[model samples]
Target: MKWFEIALVVLTLGSGLVLLLDKLFLAKRRATKGGLLDSEEPALVDYSRAFFPVLAVVLVLRSFIAEPYKIPSSSMMPNLLIGDFILVNKFAYGIRLPITNTKVIPTGEPRRGDVVVFQFPGHPDMPGDPQRGENFIKRVIGLPGDRIGFHGDTLSINGQPLAYEVKGEYVGKGRGAEMNGATLLSEALPGRTHTVLEYLGRANPAGQGDWQVPQGQYLVMGDNRDNSDDGRFWGFLPEQNLRGKAFLIWLNCSGWFCKDGFEPSRIGSGIQ
Candidate 1:
């Protein structure tokens, strides 16, 4: 479990214990006229009791409503930037028990073209253990039972070529300057259109045929096509591994991840 979650649990439990002990002490003092008078000891209930309600609300909101995540990679660059702090709607996919990640309430299923946060399948960090909380953000390319293909740098789905509009050479700003001359383009999915980067000089690695997504699984890829380690490298994403849908960028502290120190313009924009 994350340290924040552990702290929240500890705080909630500590608050409850304080309240219970306070009630018990009050009852004991009431039974006797001078039972452990105030002169004998400090207040049994700590100030934590005063913050119980606030802490509980924060815990619930973070666990079941929305949770904050930091983008650690540039897989979804141009849409999500490294060092960008985003809010993932926890209940967007389903109401799963926090920490354990076992889904108990069905909210909604992910659709094609939706940028989502999910546990990367077979990723070393994403073990069978749910407590690891390993997650990756990427665009849903092929839904379950759908066929997706990539020819050279072109994408085709179900035997039809996807429309790709060239958007000139990309000029990288931070660590992304590594791809300063990569080709930029716009890709239109079924329900959404988003910008993408393609390094035309990179050779395809054993990628000539279609990808057959299995049942209860999805095929995801990054917007930074050539640099991404996605479905092509890790295989399909299991449905049960979904975390939530990434919807908003709440803050941006470029820090060591980017050459820019802070990007104020990215905040408040919806993740497309």
Candidate 2:
């Protein structure tokens, strides 16, 4: 359980307890004695009763329905930029226990081409991060029992090359303008399509060779093929480590290098 989630649980439980105690010992007594006006009630007690329900609702929504995340890297490139504030649909996967993230209900499964956020399974050679379960966003490329490979820039799944239509150079804006000259390609998966950036000068590209994906795990790669540190570097992601599916970009703000701050054109944009 993350510290922040634990804190929310504690706060909710504490406030609920206070409210329950007040209802049983004070509110009921006042009700029988012709009721007490708002000003007459103990300030702390009244506040607890008023705020506990609000806190509980917020906790439930944030923990299980949807959660917001800020994009911190250009790994997703044309699809998701740095400073894009996104909303992840937690229930799209399943209902899980708060903090622990233990799945209790099976809602759905991830499909090829779906964009997802999950805990970054650290590389063995690298030191473990303080936030070991830090999240990352990437496209689902390989599923359990699937064979995935890449020859140069072309991706092959089960020995069949995934189709790509060149979309010419992508002129990046805001925080990712440095990638303005990169090649853009519309990659087609079985059920969906998304644009990907192919930065020049490959440094250990992930889709170079064939790999057999294991059971109960997934192989993911970033849209910015040459730049992301993803499944290729840290191995497959256990299904249990998934956070949620990122489905929307609610807001985009100036990050690093924007001439005029907010990217209103990108607002309310559905994440492909």
Candidate 3:
């Protein structure tokens, strides 16, 4: 969560400042002619010393190495189900500062067919925007400057249609049962092939169109074609909004409480 990251950074920095201040001035006052003060160390200083290292390590790992995120919707279904806890490679794209999301190092760029998490481009900075700063995951369909088009449940990139092999109807379970009857097909993209769900005879007028992707942007869509609110509904995803590439499913459990919905088979599977 954004708030979680912010709070972690604040706590780590605050504790570090306290430690620095103590080492510079407070520690001298605590020392006496007998080599130590009669009173014990302040509770605040003790807490700062105890928690600073743990907080600092967590902040560095979560912000630069990898971060865990839970699936909250069925948009990327069949591949990423609701309740799946995935680990996103924070440095997969680049090294970005926490909270500000400013890129400090150029590591790599997203390839077509990569499952990426990004900030929702729903006017996130505008006040009163409910979806502000929200994270959304989808598959990259078109790279910058690529000619992308979608019509009749088919995707075309650079004037060539992506090959699709029907894999039959998808029988979803748990919270994804509603998508059970959706048509399943294995779509072949460059460097990878993944399954996609399409509803025959269903129309998505707003999402069906052709466009030329601009530079520093990407065209993305969900595997659940008919149901996803993705680049088709919005526009090209800004490069600055890119969070990271989701590569693994670490855990999966349905519902708010950890009740009877655990999909063990999906655990440790890499996202294709």
Candidate 4:
């Protein structure tokens, strides 16, 4: 469910609880004080007094402030791994209404190298499907009007090759065990620097179709180059599908078992 929808559900339940408490406690107090014993009247007053305000606050905060999302895929490995709970700054891009996702305030636009979480535009019916509406976290490699290409596994943005230096081999985890042979590298993108993984012997698919990013859109790719299914296969993420910028890794667990314990190094780490 969309964050706004979830907020609405919570608001509804909280309001209901408050109303029930008022009827059970406040109504009895008034009755003891010699007030008119109108049962239906109390229900009306209780609902109006308790529910609307609380729901309004929740709607404003969640729609314009921040929202939490969990990483459920390895598409952004090394930067964001499976089981990583992250906080997305909703207002980082702009302020939008909850359910309708209509932007109400203009905050700012996404920049190159920002790690963003967006709803996949690929099959609309499968919204939130792990493989469909699946929230994808990736770096904005190419902006509107930018020309991007890949040569021998190297990324060339607007005809300029990005700087890359091999660091070492990545030690895979859980389902990532099969990618243990992937090489880890420190790639410098514009003003930001982050680690990326590349599988050995996998030649960059050259002569691939080029894309001219349209207005109000961006091209994103995973840090784990070969492993991610990004703009190369799917397509550019529309500005409206953007959820927010992932700024922090609040928690990281090895897997569902959480047996590996907290990763101290990854704690409080800022997303690129």
Candidate 5:
């Protein structure tokens, strides 16, 4: 479990338990001891009572409905930018329990071209130990039992080459300015079309490969093809590691040190 999820669960359960114990045992005991202020609740009980409801509501909403995330990298550039505060539909793929991440209810599977936030399958910090990695956002390129290939900045799915239309040279702003000269292209991924960035004149030997997606895994790639460290470098993503589908950018802030950090135009924009 992430640190935030662990803390939220602990605080919520602790407060609720305190409130329950006070009502069931402590309050009754105080009432029997005549002179002991039966009507006055203890400080801990009072605080628990005041906070339990609010915490419980937030827990439910965040765990089951939707949750917010901040984009700290340019993996999905041109679509999801650095400092973009996005919303993920928690129940879009399935209804999973908090911390444990066990899917109690099946909702729907992810589609091709869908932007998804998932736990990185590889442990970069502790290599060779198969632990859950940090959350990563990417676009689903291949589904189960599919043939996915990539070479020369072009993508092929199931032996069919997808078309790429050169839009123009990308001119990025803020933190994205580093990718100013990247070639912007519109990729036709089956039913969807999305913008992608590639350094046209450069070689991406590491990203050139082909793979057969297994029955319980997926193939994902970053929109910033040349700059992203994704499935191309690691391997296929296990379906169980998936968190949810990213659908919206609710806020954007450049950085804490930057003046006028807020980018109001990106707010309330839907993620394609």
Candidate 6:
């Protein structure tokens, strides 16, 4: 579901909770009192007293503090695997209203190497779009003025190669399938570090269009380089499209080894 839809659902649930609490607690007191029991009065007052305040609190916290998201793909692979439930710092990019998603505070811009969650630019109606019904999580590889290119599977930003080192193989889990001929490597992005996959002997088109990231826009890519359909295919992410910077991996729900169990190692770990 979209973020707005989820926020609506949450608001509705909170409203319901408040009404239930009022009926169970306050209605009996009013009934025992000498006041005439107006049938509609209890429901109206209960709902009004309960819903708005709770809803407002949640809206403020989620909009300005932090919001949670689940990783649904291997596009971030070694850094963030499928089923990783993470928290995003909403105020990192700026404060935006929950349902409307309009920024109200100018906190900061997305820096290079920051892992970001963004609204997918891929056309939702396109038949072959992998981003359909999904929010994409990727690392910011290139910024507004950076010239980005890839040759022989090596990423170059502003005519300089980002640091890369070979890590071990990534064993696939459950439906966490790997590409037929892909190898995982540890990649370093300026000050941030993560992992990327390289598809050797794969005939991938090199030297994509020279993107001059327009002002208030950023270029993003998956850490799992070869497997990601990122800014390379879809257009750049506008500043308004940014949700937040992903910071923590709170849970991994892959049904690989434990169908209903949690991965202890991933819990409470920070996202790079």
- Could you report the Cα RMSD, in angstroms, for every candidate shown? 3.4, 2.9, 2.0, 5.0, 2.0, 5.1
Highest TM-score, which number? 3
Worst 10 residues of 3 by lDDT: 32-41
| Pairs of residues at least 3 apart in sequence or in different chains that clash in candidate 3 | none
Residue 160 of model 2 has an lDDT of 88
Instruction: Report every candidate's CA lDDT.
Output: 0.80, 0.84, 0.90, 0.77, 0.88, 0.74
lDDT of 3 by residue, 183-263 (tens): 998999878899988897786887799989999999999999998988887778999999999999999998767574788
Off by over 4 Å in 1: 21-44, 124-132, 206-209, 256-260
What shift in Å separates residue 259 of candidate 6 from its native position after superposition? 2.4
What's the CA RMSD of model 3 in angstroms? 2.0
TM-score of each candidate structure, all chains considered together: 0.85, 0.88, 0.95, 0.78, 0.94, 0.78
- Between candidates 2 and 6, name the one with more favorable TM-score: 2
Poorest 10 consecutive residues by lDDT, candidate 1: 37-46
The TM-score of candidate 1 is 0.85
Instruction: Report lDDT (Cα) of residue 170, candidate 5.
Output: 97
| Candidate 5 structure quality by residue, lDDT tens digits, 142-181 | 9999999998878999999999999999997787777898
Once fitted onto the true fold, the runs of candidate 6 whose alpha carbons sit more than 4 angstroms away are 3-40, 124-134, 172-181, 206-210, 255-261
Write one digit per residue (lDDT tens) for candidate 1, span 122-144. Answer: 75555674523467889999998
Candidate 2 lDDT over 143-258, as tens digits, reads 99999887777888888898989899988766778688889999988788888888544646444677899999999999988778877777788899888999999989854555
RMSD of 6: 5.1
State the TM-score for model 3: 0.95
